[model samples]
Target: MIARWTSTILAAACLLAAPVLAADLRPGTAGEGNFRVNVAASGGPSELPDRIGPVSRIKDIATLLTARDNQLIGYGLVIGLQGSGDGLRNSPFTEQSIRAMLQNLGIAMEGGQARAKNVAAVIVTANLPPFVQSGARIDVSVSSLGDASSLQGGTLVMTPLRAPDGEIYAVAQGPVFVSGFSVQGQAETLTKGVPTSGRIPSGAIVERQVDARFNDDTVLTMQLRNPDFSTTIRVTDTINAYTQSRFGKRTAAEQDSRTILINRPTEVSAARFVAELENLLVETDTPARVVVDERTGTIVIGQDVKISQVAVSHGQLTVRITEQPQIVQPAPFSDGVTAEEPSTTIDAQQAGGQVAMLEGPDLQTLVSGLNRIGVKPDGIIAILQGIKSAGALQAELVLQ
Candidate 1:
C-alpha cells in the first residue's frame, strides 16, 4: 500500500540521517534543539514543546524578609474519652491537673485518690501568622502526651498558648475532631489512623497583638525561595524595568544571588510599593538537571536538558529454573525398594531487544530513540546512566 511505502521511506530517511546529524556535533559542543523536560508517568511520556516555560508573578517566587510566622505551644487536658482515656494511676500528671482545676473552681479534692479514666494530658500547638491581630481565631492541633488510646469526642479545657518569651498570646479550648478510630476485641485489636492526634478549626483566639508595622520602613528586602544566579538576575532586571517606566528611575538593587533591596518612593507607602512589586512578571531560568530516585524508579528532567548522539544496544535476558520430584517403583520380583528422583529444567529467553542509534539534540529525538528500542522504565534508566558515563548526556545526573 502507499501508506506502507511512505512509512518505509520515512524509516529509511531516519536511519540515513544519523551520521549527518552526528557530524554536526563538534567537540565539546551541545546538540541543537529546544526542549522542556517533564514526563508525567513511566512508559507514558508527556509531550514537551519546543519553547521554554511560562513567566510567573514575583509573589509566587519570592517573599518579604520581615513577614514570618511565630509558633505557640501550651500544655492542656482533654476530657470525655469514653473509657479509652489514660489511667490516672499510670499518668500522675493527669491526676494532678484534675486536682488543680478543681481547686481553681473552689471545689476541693479530698486526700483520697482520683481514679478517673476519662481524662488525658495533651499538648496544644498553633501558628501565629505575621500581622495577625488580637481577637483573630486560628486553628490548633492537639497531641496526646499520656497513654491515651483515642482523643475522639473529647473537649479540651482552657489552655494558654505561649511564645518563646513565656508570654501567653492566645487561649485555646474546643471540641476535638479526630479523623481516625480504634476498636479492640478480646483476641485482637484494629486501628485506622492514629486516633491520639486531632485538630480544631478556629480553636484559639489571640489575646495579645504582635507589634508589626509593614509600612513603617522606607526600604525592604525580598528573598527568593530557591537561590539561583540566572533567576536572581532576571528578577532584578524585571523590577528595574518596571520602576524606570513608572518613576523615570530605578529603585531596586540586587545585593546577591538570594537577596534584593528596594527603596519605596517617598510619595508611595510601603504597602502600595510592595503590592506593585510582587505583581511584576519575570521569566525564570533553571539549570539542566536530571534527578533519579532508584528506590521508586522516578525520573525528573529539567527543561534545558539535552543529549549527544550515541549508539545504544539494550536487551533483557530472563532465565527460569524449575524443579520436580519423581517416584521410582521397584521391579515385580526383585528385593528392590521404591525411591524418589529429582528432576530439573531451565528456560532462557531474550525478547524485544534491539540495537538503535540515538540522535539527541532535543527531548523529542531522545525519546524517539528510546521508543525505537521498545524498552521499559528500567531499561530507560540504565541507558540514561550509560549515556552519562560515555559523556553523551549534556545535563547533570543526580541519583537519590
Candidate 2:
C-alpha cells in the first residue's frame, strides 16, 4: 500500500514539472528585458542654392505688393516649472493676471496672496502672416517678464493676442517648447542656452483674418527686399518681356528704385498675372558694399565691392607687469627684523609688421591681399575702417 501511494505522488509531481519545463523552452518566456532593433533609413542628396550670380524667382526676391505680416502681442502665465519660476510675492502682476484669468473662468478668489513659485508671467508675441485664414496655426515666442530662473517645462495658458489696432487677431495656448534646461542641486547648478525664453511651434490659432486690399485692387505692386535701380529695371523688363511673349502687350513698369508697378490686363485676371510673374526668373543686382558686424567681427564683401590703391599696416604693442613679494630674515646674531620686500617685473614688447599695398581690380585680389597681411579680425576691421575713411574703399561701408 505504501509503494502504490509513493508512485502516485511521484506521477503527480512529474505532471506539474512537465508544463514548467515546456514553458521555459518556449520563446519570449525568458525573464530578461525585451530587445529592440532600430533601422536607419537612407536619405537622398540635397539641393543647395547658388550664391554667386544666383537667379531667384521674382516672388523669392520680393514681398507681395501689399501683403505683409502684422505683429501680435499678449501677456500670459506659464506654469509647471521645477522651482525656476517667478516669485509670486515679488511679482504682483503675475498674481493679478492669475486673478483675472480665474475670474474669467467663473472662479472667484477673494485674496491676492497666492504664493506659487512654479508660475511665471510672460510676454507672448507672434506674427500674423498675410492671407492666413481663420483656424490656422502660427508660431509664438514667450519671454519671462519678471525674475524667473528658467522657463523649461512650462505650459502657456490661453491668451488673446492683439494687434496694434487693439483688435484680437489670434489666441495662443500650448506647451512651451524649450530647447534648453536648468538644473540645480545642493552642490552646484547647471544651465545651457537661454532658460528664460522659449518658443512654441504652432502655438497660436488665428481667430480673425486681416482683409487683403490687393484682392480687390486693379493694380498690384512688387517691392524688392534689397532695393536697387538696376534690379528694379531688370525685374520690370523681365515681366514686360514675358507679357509681350504671352499676351503681346507690356503690362509692367518701374515706378522707382524699389517699386515696380504692374498694370493688370483686362483679359488676364490678377491671380493669373501674379502667378505667372512671380515665377519669372530675374538675375539679382546688388550694390557694392561691405557689411561689417562689429559685435561678431564678421565682414561680408559684396560682389561689386572694390578697393582703390591703399597701404595698410597692422601691429600691436603689449605691456605686462607682475609683482612678487619676498620675506627677508635677519641672521641669528644680527639685530634685524623679518620684513616683506616687494619686487615687480615689467615686460614690454611689440609685434613686428610690414605695410602691404592693396590694389583690387577684382574681389579675389582684395581677399588675397587682406589674407597676406596675416592680421586678426579686429585688426582687419580697423584697417577697413581706416581705408573707408580715407575714401580708398569704393564700396559703401556699413557698420552693424
Candidate 3:
C-alpha cells in the first residue's frame, strides 16, 4: 500500500513539472521592416515663415547660428587636503607646485624638504558664453591630475582658465562640490563613484571677452549642424515667403544644405532683425533610419517608417530529459546487499501552439504586426537582420 501511494505522488509531481518547463519555451517571427515613406506636410507656408525667422533680417539668424559657449581650460593646484591628496613622493609636480605657491606666500622651502600630503595637482575647466561680459559668473569643473583619492571639501585657489588662444578668459576659485564620499579604517575602506573630480556652480568670473562680430556682416549665415537639403530648402523658401509679403522681395538664399545667406534689412536693428528670422516656421524632413542597440534592447521608430508586403512565421523546438532512480532490496532477510539503479530518458517536442504570421503593407501595419506577435527586442534584431538579408527593409540599419 505504501509503495503504491509513493508511486502515485511521484507521477503527479512529474506531471506538474512538465507544464513549467513548457512555459519556458517561446516562438518569435523574424523579418526586416521598411522605414522610408513620404512625410505629410504639417503646418504650411504661414507656419514655415514663422518657425525660422524673418527673411529681410540678417542679424537674428546669425545670432541663432553662433556657438553656445567657448571652452576654457587650465592646469592648477588643489590644496588643504586631508591626507586624501596625491602622494608628493610619487608625483614630483605636486611638490613643485606646492613649493612655488608657498614661495609666493613668503615661505622659503628647501628643494627636498617641501614634501606635503595636503597638496594636489588639478585641471580646471569652464565655459565662456558668447555674451558673457566682464565680472559675469560661470560654473567650473575641477579634476585631479594626480592619484588623489578624493577632492571632497577642497578649495580651488584662484585658477586662471584660458581659451585655445592662450589668453586668460576666466578666473575659477571656490569650494569644490565633489559628488562622492569615502571612508577608511585600518583593515577596510569604502568608496563610491569618483571623489577625485568636482564642480563649482557660478564659481568663475569672466575676465576677458572673445572678439566676435555678429552685426557687421552684410550677409548673415544660418548654419545647420546636420545639413539636410530638404530642410535647407524649406528654411530658404519660408524666409523668402515671409520677406516677400513683409519687405517687398526675397532676401534669403539657400547656399547649400549646411548654409543659408540672408541680406540684412536696413529698416531693423541687427538684433531685432535676426530675432524675426529665427521665428520663421520651416517644416523639415529627416531621413528614414532604424537604430538598434543590441546591448540594451532598445528600438526607436520614426513616424515615417514604412514596410512592403511580407509574411512571417514563428515557432519553437524543445528537448527535455528525465532521470529516475530505482532501489532494490534483499529478499526475505537474505545476506544480499541492497543497491539502486538510475533510468534516464530523452524526448524532443515542438511547442503546443500555432505559428504566428505577420502580414505588413505599410509602417502602421508592420508595427502592429510586430506588436501583436509580442516580439522581444532581441528577437526584433534577428527579424530585422533577416529582413535586410531578403532585400526588403528600406531603412538604414545602424547597430550599436
Candidate 4:
C-alpha cells in the first residue's frame, strides 16, 4: 500500500509539472494581454483576500478551499466473535460492558458475571458532515476498545456516535471489515498491519445535521485561509467590479484581511444569493512564498517568488574507515598462545563540484538558473536561505 501510494503521488507530480511550469512562467498583476487578465475573476467584495478566487465559471477554487466533514465517535461492542475476541478474564471491562448492554435490553445478570467469549468491546467512529440528512450512510472505523487480539470477521453492534454537543448524530452498526489478516499457532503468531482495528463502508446512518448557515442577515462574509493585504484588495475590487457590472450596483465591501461583507438582496433568498456570489469570477494574486519539505526532499515555489544576484557553493564531506584483523601464532612453540590483532584506517574526501552563480531578473530566471546548476531540493533550500540572508530573495521561506 505504501509503494502504491508513493507511485501514485509521483505520477501526479509528473502530470502537474508542465502546468505548474507554465503558470510560473506567466506574468502576475492585471493588464491587457497578460496572464492575470486571462485568468477568471469572481464577484465578491474587492479588497478581500487574494486566495479567494480563480475567477473561473466552474467554482473549482471554492470547492478546493472548503471543508465539509465532522468527526463522530462512540464506544460500542463487537459480538459473534469466533474465539478471536478479548479474553474476558484479563479484560474485566469487556465483561462489565457486556453486562450493562444486556441489562439495557432487559436481560438481568445478577452478579455481573457474564462469561461471553463471542463478544469484544470496540470503539466506533465515523464522519458526520454538514447537509447530511437523517438516514444518510457514511463509513465507520471500528477499533478494539479492550485487549482483543484481533477483530477479523466480527460484527459491531448498534452504537450511537455523538458530537461535542453531547447529542447523538449518527448510529453505526455492521460487519467489521479488516484490511489485513493474522495467523496464530501454539508456538508462533504472525500478524500484518493492525489486526485489532477495521472499517465498515456505509455502516453508519446520520441521525441529525449540523447547522452551517452562510446567510442570516444582510451581510455575508467570505474568509481567506491565508491573510494578505494585496490579495485581499484584489479580491475586494474583483467582487465590486463583477457585481456592479452584473447587477448594476455595488453590493460588497472588504472588511479586513480575512473577511469580506456583501449586501444580501431582498428579492433573493440567502442561500441563492450566496450561491450566486460564490459563482462570480475573480482573479487572485498569490503572495510570494517558497515551501520546502525537508523530510521528503520536496520544494514548492509560488509564481511570485523572486531572487536577486547570488553565488552558491555546496560541497559534501565523506569519511571512510577500514578494519583488518590478523591472527598471531606462537613462534616455534615459545611460551606464547594464538592471539588476534586489529588494525584501523580512516580517509576523508570532498565531492567534486564547482561553485555556481545565480543571476535572476525575475522568478522564472531564478528557477531556471537554479535548475541549470543541478541543485536538488536540499541544495536549493540552502541556496534560498543564503539568498534571503543576503537580502536577495524577496519571499518568505517556510520549512516543514
Candidate 5:
C-alpha cells in the first residue's frame, strides 16, 4: 500500500509539473504531449557556431598516398565437412583439385577421378597490406565455389595465395572457423547468416615482401579520405605553419582537393618526418545536412541548419471497425436453413485537426515549435517536406 501511494504521488507531481513547464514556453507554443526532437548539434545548441567539428590528426583524415594494400587470391579445397560437403560428380573442380594433391604426393592417379562427399572446392583470398614482412601471419577468407551447404566444421587444405603479378606471396591452411551454422530436416529447415563462407584468422604466412618506396622519393604525398576544398586548404596551411615554425620554411602545399605534397627536409629522417607530420591537428568542416531514416523514425539535424518562418499542423485520423455476427434459427417443425450473417460497422474520427502556427528565428525555436504540436515522427516527416518545399528549411534533407 505504501508503494502504491508513492506511485500515485509521483504521477500527481508529474501532472502538476507539466503545466508549470508549459507555462514557461512562448506565447504561440502549442500544448505539449508525447513527441519531442532531441538533437545534439556539433556546436552548442544555443551558440550554433559556424564550425561543425574540432581538431583532428592528419593521419586520421588521410592515407599515405603511395602505400596501399595488395589483393591476393588462391584456389583450394575444404575437407572434413560432414555430408554437407559438395557432391564430387557435380563439382568437377573438387575432384580435380583432390587428384592434383594426391599426384603431388607421388600417388599417380589416372583420369583424375576422385570421389568424396566430404570435400568441397573453395576460393581463398587475403589482402596483403603494405609493410607486412615475410613470415607475417594474415587472415584469409574462404568461400565455397561449389554446391556445399555449409563450410562449418571443415578444415581447409594447403592453398597458395598469389598477388596479381602471379607470384605466390603467402600460404594459407588451417581449420575453418564458421561463425554461423545450418541444419536441414525432413520437416523443417533453420539457418543463420551465411553457412558457405568463413574465415581463418591469421592462417596465412606471408612468404614475400612488397617493397614500398617511402624514402626514395624526395616528396611524400598524402591523400584525404574525403575530398573537400576547404579541408585541403586547411591541411596545407596547418602543415605549413608547423613546418615554418620548426624549419624556417613552408614544406607542404596542397596539390589538389585530395592530395597534399610534403617536401622531405634534409635534417630529419624520412620516417621521422612523416611520423611527426601525421600527428598535427587541423579543424575539419562538414556540410549542413539533415538525415532522416524513414524506417526507424530517426532524424538528425546539423548545427548550422537554419529555417525561415514556417507553419506546421499535423493531425491523426483514427479508424475503428466492429463486426457482429447474428444467427437465425428455424422455427420448431418448420423446415428452414439457419445462416450466419456478418454486420460490420466502421467508425473514423479526425481529432486535433486544427493547424498550429509554428514560427522560429533560430534552430532551437524551430525545434521547440515543431515539438509543441505533439506531432508523431511520420507526421513530422510530411510537415518537414512541406516546409522544405515552401523554401523554409535551409539544410539539405537526406533520406535513409
Candidate 6:
C-alpha cells in the first residue's frame, strides 16, 4: 500500500512538472490561511523616452535570414534503467521496438515475449546547427515515449535524428543525464523536478551539413527578432551609413519592416561583410508592452509602458461562512433521544477603497503610483486590466 501510494504521488508529480511554469508560492492552505495581493514597484530618478533609447548591436537584435538551426527528431531506445522502464503489457510499442532491435542484433527468441525490466522507449530530439561540420557534435534531449517511471540512469541507443524532410542529419547515442531525481522508500517517495526526461551534452554527431551557402551568398537578408518600423529604419540607415563611409557604396536597403536586404560588396566576401555589419551599434525601438502572467502573478512592465491620468480605487470584499454542529441530550427520565443541532454563521467584510491619481510618464513613475495604492499582485493585475479596458494604458496589455 505504501509503495502504491508513493508511486501514485511520483506519477502525479511527474505529470504536473512536465510543463514548467515559474511561480512564487506562499506558505498557506486554501481555507485556513490568509492570502494577500502584492505588487512589486521600482523607481528611477529620470523618465526614459517613449519610443527610442538604448543602443544594441545588430547581431543582438537580428539574425541572418538563412542562418538557423534545423530541428531533428527520432524515436529511440533508452536502456540500463533500474526497474523503471516501461512494461511490455502496458506499452506494446516498447515491446515491438525491443523485438525489432533484438532481431536486427541476431538475437531472436522462440518464445512469445522477451520481457525486460531495464529498457525503455524514448524520443530523441536535437537541433542541427547551420554551418556545422560533419564531425561536430551537438546536444540531444531524451524524453520518455512510454510508461517509464524515470529516465534517471538510462543510456540512449544509436538513434538517427531526421529533419522534417525525412533526411537524417545527426546520430544520437549516449548516457542520459537527468537533472531531476526521484527517491522512493517503503512508506514515502520524493521527486524533485522531472526524471522522465534528460539531456546528453554533445551526444549527437552531425551526419550531414545543412544546405546553407552563407559565405558565398550574393544577396544577404537580415531578419529582425522583433518587427518595428522605427527599428528597421534605424538599422537600415546605420548599415547604409557604415557601408558608405567604409566601402564608398550603399549596400543596405530595407525590404520590409522585418527584413533588410544587403548587397554583398564585390571587394569583400559575404562572411567578412556580415562580420563587419553585425558589430555596428544602432538604437532599437519596441512597442509599449505590459506582460502579465495570471497563473504566476508575474507582471513584467516594459520601459515604455505608460498610463494616462486616471483615479484608481483598490479594495477587497471577503465573505466567510462557518458551520457548527452541537449534540443535544434529553434530561434524565425524559423520553427524548440525542439530536444534532446545526448552526451556521455568515459574515461579510469589505475594505474601503483608496482612490489615487495614476499617471506615468515612465515605468518608474507608473510603478511608484501603483505602489502608493498598496495593491498586491492579484489586485494590481485587475487594476491593470481595468485600465487597459478603459483605454488609459498606453502600452499593449498582454495577459498570459
Best by lDDT: 6
Candidate 1: 10-residue stretch with minimal lDDT: 9-18
Query: Which residue pairs in candidate 2 have backbone atoms (N, alpha carbon, C) closer than 3 angstroms, thus clashing?
Result: none
Candidate 3 per-residue lDDT over residues 1-400, each given as its tens digit = 3233222211111011112222111111011122111112322332333233223223332334432466778767777888888887788777777766666566778755765677778888877777677889999999998988989878887667766555556777789999898999999999987899999999988877665455544456577655767677777777778877888867776666777666766676656767777876556566666788999999876545555555655545778999988898989869989899888889988752444565555568878878876667777777777777776677777889
Per-residue accuracy of model 6 over 1-400 as CA lDDT, tens digit each: 2233222111111111122221111111121213221111111111334445889999999988656666777787899999999998998888887776766666776677858888888888887776788889999999998898899889987777766655556778899999988889999999998899999999998876765556556667788999987788788778877888898866666756898767776699778888999999988888999999999999999988989999998889999999998999999999999999999999999885878899999899999998888888999999999999999999998889
Each prediction's Cα lDDT score? 0.75, 0.75, 0.66, 0.67, 0.74, 0.77
lDDT (10s digit) by residue, model 2, range 1-400: 3233222211111011112222221122111223211111111111233335769899999866456677788778888887888887778787777776676566778964677888898888998887788989999999999898999899988777767655567778889988877888999999898889999999998887876544354566678999987777778778877888898866666667897666666687667778989999988878889989989999999877889998887888899999999999999999999999999999998884688898787899989999899988878898899999999999999999
Point out the higher-scoring one by lDDT: 3 or 4: 4
How does residue 19 of candidate 5 score in lDDT? 22
Better of 5 and 6 by lDDT: 6
Candidates, ranked, lDDT: 6, 1, 2, 5, 4, 3
The estimated TM-scores of all candidates read 0.73, 0.81, 0.71, 0.73, 0.73, 0.85
Model 2 RMSD vs true structure: 22.9
Candidate 4 wrong stretches, greater than 4 Å = 1-70, 79-91, 106-120, 144-152, 178-198, 210-215, 245-248, 362-364
Any idea what lDDT model 5 has?
Answer: 0.74
Residue 24 displacement (Å), model 6: 43
Query: Could you tell me which 10 consecutive residues in candidate 4 have the lowest summed lDDT?
Result: 8-17
Q: Give Cα distance to truth, residue 278, candidate 4, Å.
A: 1.4
lDDT by residue for model 4 over 1-400, one digit each (tens)?
2233222111111011112222221212111121121112333443343354345431433331122566677777888778888888888877777776666666779965777677888777777755566778999999886777788889987777766445556777899999877899999988898988999999987776665443334555566656655655665666666667767766656556765555555677766766676676656556789898889988888877887777777766789999988999989959999999998889999883678788776668987998887857877787777888899888889989
lDDT of 1 by residue, 297-377 (tens): 887877677888788888789999999989999999999999999999999998756678887676677667777888877
